[model samples]
Target chain A: MEKNKKNKLSIVSLVKKYLPATVALVPLTIIPAPAYAGLITIAVSSTGALNFGSLDAGGTGGTVVISPAGARTQTGSVVLLSGAGLESAGLLSISGSTGVLIDVAMTNPAFAITGPGAPMNVGGFNIDGGGSSVSLTLPTNPATFPLGATLTVAAGQTAGVYFGTYTVMANYQ
Target chain B: MKNTKKGSDIGKALLMGTALVSLSSYQAEAATGTGLMSAIILTPIDVTSTQVLHFGSMSVTTAVGTITVVPNGTGGTRNAGTGSVTEIAGAGLESEGALQITAATGLVMNVALTAGPFTVDDPGAGLPMTVDTFMGQAVPAAFPFTTSIVGPATNVIVPVGATLNVPAGQEAAVAGITPATFTGSYTVDVNYM
Candidate 1:
């Protein structure tokens, strides 16, 4: 016929080029095959600070503790201020604030601790008798303010407690 | 020329597979950057002078005499300040507050580790006990100034250039210093110069 119509138009142009390449493989196989394949995440961040350590001659309100393994970076929080003023006139205040948390304890091998209050700063005459009361009677330590709650040291008692060693500094500014 | 050389090898394999899918999508198009700052730290309780317990302002004479203090040494450096102008030992008088000995040039100095050796009696006396509190620190207690103590190391720190040469006649020994368990305290401003 024209040669049989050129072989049926080359078999209808190879079925229209394989029917759009088999319809692009049916969207790569029914499209219901995504299986969520692109995403992953995890996060953590905590800027740091807590450098507390200083209670020399801790006689007025007496307290000292800071251990969390002595800390360098425990994830932060311990501000305690008031450092310059020891020419010897006496005006050192550390009752609270500077990153407050005045007394939080537990140490001896166990860590994470604190207790820094009572550096009350006084000295016009409360010398040892603490007569007008400035806090000094430490026997067996009921918090130690011993002058005579019947703590008994009789004889001629004048002044005692000779312990000294300060500078408990800490920081992760 | 051969179908344009087979369409330039399929456009060079689609630009190398679109750069291998954009370098494997670099961990899903990742991007992160951060920074922060603020500082000022210091914790110092360095009341340095090393060690001192000197005295000598001139009007010294209360009674239990033996005065000679000043790094002199007998026990360690010098311990020849044995004084006594008063004798009243047994204890019973607790003033949590309201105690003052203003012009007695007071040095109720009580450093007893007692079992024995402490006495203060004079001023005719009857019940003139006068404790005002000793080691816990606070003699004048608080009148027109800051006063209160009971701290770590328990104050002996008189560092300002320190020169407490309490000489004149020196007398207020009452040091029975008992510490089987007895902490310390003081507030001696015997300024009778």
Candidate 2:
């Protein structure tokens, strides 16, 4: 019994003596770099001002509609002129480096115009050149498309220059 | 007997040293770093135009003139000749193209601009004019900019200014329409390195 106890004590002492040295070797493992690497870039610009220039709602009044697909049409008694008085759909060009599908978000999905009277709602606002909310694969480096808003008019609405601001955003998937 | 005992002691020392080294290596193999791994899957860099780049209402003289606007967001003036490049007082943020960039951090990016030779046509008249020059500057005027991922936001402001070169007599020849603005847009890309 005495001999066995002595041996056990020696083994404990040996363990204590070498424990610190064992701990010192912990920092030498090799590490490698991450497997994937790349970055993406995106840009946007209004190809031209979204101008609903000089419109005559006539004496009765009418609605001027511009579609996101670059179509312009009028309802009611509105008459659009062509002699230097041009009305055009707003064009926004989206550029992306990833060449992948991206999400587009818009602030103030609706806008309004006012002139010497109560504000008029310019509803049916669209920015994706299609539906209101859509994700699209960047077709080109700088893909140019139309963003449109429809001006709703009340009968006998006042005529003057009206203005407002809206914003469009893009993000990667 | 004495020499043999000394040899045995040396052998025991060597064995203990070897055992210590082997145990230490095993402990090291089980140990892990405490510094933590930090990473971010960067979102695509996005740029939005808050303001359009415009020289603002310019009038040209019979003489060929060049309008140069500095990139400091200052309005430009026509070179001495016949035309006038008056800074439209309080013309808003039209003199320089104001834009905002949003993305992740730790990125070294390259900025490239593709511009110039943009054409604007007179409606129905068929006489189209050309804007021969356009230029831009990145904010802080540094290439390969580095940014932080942890902050209130990870975004930068890049203000770009442009110069429009009108030939000798192209101003008055433009279509006679009020607010008959000319359009010229340049493509700017932020490439990652």
Candidate 3:
């Protein structure tokens, strides 16, 4: 049958001449680091002046302990990145860094606000001792722009507010 | 020739194994990375706190002093931690309040029986209300600090809408209470779990 139609036209011209060099080795995905979606600006002081929607509902534990302006133990800290070549990290379940300075003796309680009782240092100007783990280090190659170091006072885990001022909170997944 | 050179050596090993699986699909799949970073930056912290303890009976009383937990017993005299308790980490801890002492002649001469959380809510069912704002400061005395229990200070961890501390060892002391010099807000709502 015409020699099997000339071998199916010589295997369709050898798959169209090596198929564009095998589709140019099938690469050219040009994402270099695509998956971008950023917006980080956690900077607070004394109830942190409010952001994210301006919350203030009776505000006590959920968070809200503004005491900015020179601060004292209402300290602060934030350092987590994620947006460039991607490699940020995880585990930041926080609960307001405890600054406990007790004395009611219903039982035994006694541990007075250590770490960085936040004395103003997050975005208002570096000063973190609020340490419990918020150090992702964000400066690998030329990337450092994913922010998050709050203190609007939600009081729980122990990362409790510090120095005396706060702002920026209400984050989700 | 030899079966056409063994079918051209199996077509050049299937064309270099499809060009190395299309060049490793453009790399970066270290089996999944939740560590995505291309522009996430935030570095500004000098000190933070969480305390974190797992054991039990821990004391810290520098002066406003008085800690008397009594689970099995053996707990008192405290000046605990100190300047941020080494800056706590991971688990979390640090909280201690209620210590009113003043003596200019207003009242509350020296009342500070540690162990705290709450600060100004409920003040019961666990303990948290210890008041004494030192009417007028001129000499009062007794006011050093370093307290931090946050975690296993006997039985920490207070959550659920939160508000319950000063329960664990239970013991009150306001005795003659009359010393004033900035005595009122000794706040301590612990646990950052």
Higher-lDDT candidate of 1 and 2: 2
Fnat of model 1, as a fraction: 0.01
DockQ of candidates 1 onward, in order? 0.03, 0.01, 0.03
Interface root-mean-square deviation (Å) of every model? 15.2, 19.4, 16.4
The candidates, ranked best first by DockQ, are: 1, 3, 2
In the range B1-193, model 2's lDDT, one tens digit per residue, is 1236544454355333322222211111011111010011124556688667666555565456555544554432333222544434444434566667675454444555544456655465323555544544543343233332345668765666545655545545654655556664556666443
Off by over 4 Å in 2: A1-37, B1-193
Give the alpha carbon lDDT tens digit for every residue of A1-173 in model 1: 99889757754554444344434322222222222233222111112222232222212322222222322111112222233221111111112113311221111111222123211211111112332123211222112111101011112212222211111111111
What number of clashing residue pairs does each candidate have, in the order they appear?
A: 84, 2, 133
Candidate 2 lDDT by residue in tens digits, A4-63: 997577655554554565543233344332222232356555665555644445445677
lDDT of 3 by residue, B1-193 (tens): 1235544554343342232222222221111101110111111111122221111232322223222211111111122323211222332222322222211121111222234321433222222333332111122223222222332232221111111122222223322322211112333321111
* Candidate 2 clash figure, as a count: 2
Q: Of the true interface contacts, what fraction does each candidate have?
A: 0.01, 0.00, 0.01
- Tens digits of per-residue lDDT for model 1, B1-193: 1235434444343221111112222221111211111111222122223332322212225542332222212211122333442212233211121122221111122222223222223333211122221221223122123322233323332211111122222333322322111112233332111
Error at B131, model 2, angstroms? 59
TM-score of each: 0.23, 0.36, 0.18
lDDT of 3 by residue, A1-173 (tens): 99999766754554444345644445434333322123232211121121111121111323212221222222232221111222211121112112311111001111112233333222222113322212322222212222222333232223322222222121112
